[model samples]
Target: MSVDVITFGLNHTSAPLAVREQVSLAGELMKPALTALRSAFGGAVREAAILSTCNRTEIYCAAEPSAARELPAWLADFQRVEADALQPHLYRHSQDEAVRHAFRVASGLDSMVLGEPQILGQMKDAVRTAEDAGALGTLLHQLFQRTFAVAKEVRSTTAIGEQSVSMAAAAVKLAQRVFGDLRQVKVLFIGAGEMIDLCATHFAAQHPARMTVANRTIARAEGLAGKISAGTMRLAELPEHLAEYDVVVSCTASALPILGLGMVERATRQRRRKPIVMVDLAVPRDIEAEVARLDDVYLYCVDDLGRLIQTATDARKAAVVQAEAIIETRVQHFMHWLGTRRVVPVIRDLHEAAGAMRAAELERARRALARGDDPEAVLEQLAHGLTQKYLHGPLAALNQSEGEHRDQLLTWLPKLYPLRER
Candidate 1:
């Protein structure tokens, strides 16, 4: 079976967070999801990688072509969404199209914010998770390694990432709208991952009155806090410290909501109804949606940030055209490599078969010479034996063929077995 290199998924462009969260796989759950996908599909799917990020959840697979067709149904079943409902939001690509998609994604062309660099790290994380899950194979491994290379090349060659508006920047922009001056507000980052780190950096630059990092792992929180000279606390201490900060940004891989309606309600009451700007960057959401209804709690999910970043769409379109041209050229180059790979087995078989035929004929010629036959005559016999054996099948086919088939074979034979005129 021929394996297709493919990617299919929904992203910020296709579906809202309400739908995206249902399909998003937490890091811990990825291995199990990969295992289940392999088990369900069997050998049709040889190698698989799942990339679940805040903006997208894409599956990259090196699998039989049939698996590509069937994957959507499998995803729908796994996500417990209607197949029809998911189909419209999902995009599928095969072969070079898949390679192009992977490259563009890593290079940030497909990002909600054009040329944002975070998706590359997220893709790397997903690749690592797939490796740990034992879902990575030579095809996917090579594809991703090249993907990173392409992303690096594009970043260096073009101004793709320059002056790009990042999700972190958008988060900061939203916070500024709520709080007139970020310098007077205290900011809390409720996760130690890349997104939280980024948000911390943006807010830290604004020189907030106080900055705190709260994480399930206090060590990680402290590590991030130390980088920005911010205070750190364990996630368990959030309830007590929640009211102290006016701006809250939380993005974690947690499967459940970290900040519930009640928690925020209590925190708001403690602050005497002072406005609290909350940005929930997690797919499953770190802040509860119900908290958005509360008067003092201004809750913003991933979708909210996505909207803020959309303003760059017009400016990015020009770069996108250039990026697409680069991607198209690279796709063709990769496909040519794939094509060369396909005929490798045929080339190997031809070499082995011809070597065996040569060896057998040479052995026969040596025996004849030992039996006192003339060397020149024996060499002639050897040449005849090799030539006859090589041409036997085609000669017989041509002779047996009739009408148009015979004429076609006659036309092809001389070209296939060209003779040097004496």
Candidate 2:
């Protein structure tokens, strides 16, 4: 089978938030999803990893050709959606295409914000998770190692990361507009996922009066809170503590809103008309839209941050051009490597055939020697037999060819079988 180290998935470019969220895999579910993917495809899938971020959900696998063909069906089954429904949003890449996609992704070329640096770290985390799940293999390991190298080269050689506005930084900017100075504000974060963690980091750096994390699981909340030396609270406690914080930022995968209009109204009353800034970075939204109507509460959604970040597009365009050039050069280099891999089987076959011919000739010489033939004659015959056998096919083909074909073979033969004259 012509197995390919391949990748398939949907990203922000291909799918809407509604569809992306439906198929998104939680970090905790990654291991089970990988195991299920392997089981569904059997031996065709040798190794597999799933990277599910808010912006993308990709499956990377070392699988046979048949398995690559069958991956869409497996994804449909895993997500419990119709194959046709998922197929429209999906993109597939094999061998070099796969390698190029991975490199671009790690280098941030494929990000929603082109040339963002966060993706490289996210990709590293994906690799670590894959290794922990025993999903990494020779093919993926080599691919990732090279991927990281390419990312590093792209960053160092190009201005890709210059003038970049991170989501965390955007959050801070949005909060600043509402609350004036974050230093005097208490910021509360809902959920301890990567987004919340990042938001916490940026806001904490502003030296907010206090930072608090509220998670469905208090342990997770405490874990993230401890990292930033922030306070922790249970999700249930958010209703009570809502009024205490001046700024509230939330990003969670909860199917429903965690913060409602009533809670915010209550919090606003408790704060006695003081302005409360809120940013809901989640798709479904952790804070309700109705809360935005409150007089003293200023609420911003993901789209708002997206709009704010868009202002930097013109400023960063020149850097993006430089980054794309770097990515293109790396892509060409990777494609050359992939092309070399394709001829490996032919090279192996040639080596095996030559070895067999040598063995056959050595046996013949041994038999002749045992029969008491002259040692010099036996050795001469062995060398002649081996040379003739090796050259027979090519010689016969070259002799029979005519016109341009003959000329082409004649030119190629000299290079293939060079002779040194004494």
Candidate 3:
């Protein structure tokens, strides 16, 4: 049975925030997800890796083609979502298409914000997680290594990442649009994760009138706060303190909304219709969707920020063409490697059969030598036996074949043996 490379999942483009959040896996859930996927396929999924981020959730696997079709339903079952509902948002890629998708994703060509570099690190982390779960086999290992190489080549050789604009920068741009001058607004950041750290840095550079970091872990909040010379607060204090800030940015791994409609409503009441900018970069979302409906709240989710950052410069447009060409060339290279692997089992069987034949002939020769037969005659017989045995298969095929097959065999035999020239 030949194994195939397959990629299946949904991203910001294919699925909305609501659909994506339902299936998104946190960093700690990767191992368990992979193990479950492997078990669900009854070992047919020979190798697997799951890459989940705020913007997308993807599963890459090496499996037989027969088992590939069932993957979409399996994902729905595992994520406890209705298969019918999830199917529309899902995509499946196999063989060369799978290799191309992996390359494009790592190169950031497939990102919500094109040419963003963060997805490469996220992909590396996913590979590491798969390795830790013992789900990474030779095929996937080779794929990711080539994926990283392609990403590096694209970034270095092209201007793909040049004039880079990230989600963090987008958040700052949104806030500035709302408040006119960031220095006049009080900014509050929720969660101390990478996204929040980035938002803090960008907003800090703007010199907000006051900045604060609130996290479930006070120590983490304080650590991030100290770097930006901001104050720290416990996440629990948000209810009481929410109205004090003109700008609020949040990104966390929490499975539930930290700021619900009721909470935001109360905050709005306290502010007396004063405008507030809210950026929620979380997958499950730190703020509830209903908060967007509030009159005084300017709400932006990951998708909204995605829209804000897509104003690409002319250089970036040209860079995209260059990056895509690089990715296409690398994808072909990877597919060629996959194609060559199909002959591996046949080569292995040939070597094993030859070894057995050689051993049998050697044993017969040893017995003759023990019986004191002529050494030169034994050596000649052994050489003739090996040569004849090696030629038997092709010779028999050539004799049995009628036309085209025989012609192919005749053409290939000389290539198999350049000694025919002598």
| Candidate 1 segments whose C-alpha is farther than 4 A from its true place | 77-85, 132-134, 313-316, 363-377, 396-415, 419-422
TM-score of each: 0.90, 0.82, 0.94
Q: Evaluate model 2: give its TM-score.
A: 0.82
**What value of lDDT does candidate 3 attain over all alpha carbons?**
0.92
| Cα lDDT listed for each candidate | 0.88, 0.83, 0.92
Write down the RMSD of candidate 2 (Cα, Å).
3.9
- Between 2 and 3, whose TM-score is larger? 3
lDDT, candidate 3, residue 281?
A: 95
Clashing pairs in 3: none
The order of the candidates by lDDT, greatest first, is 3, 1, 2
Which residue pairs collide in model 1, if any?
A: none
| lDDT tens readout by residue for model 1, 353-375 | 99999999999998998999999
Cα lDDT, model 2, residue 59: 89
Q: Model 2, poorest ten-residue lDDT window? A: 306-315
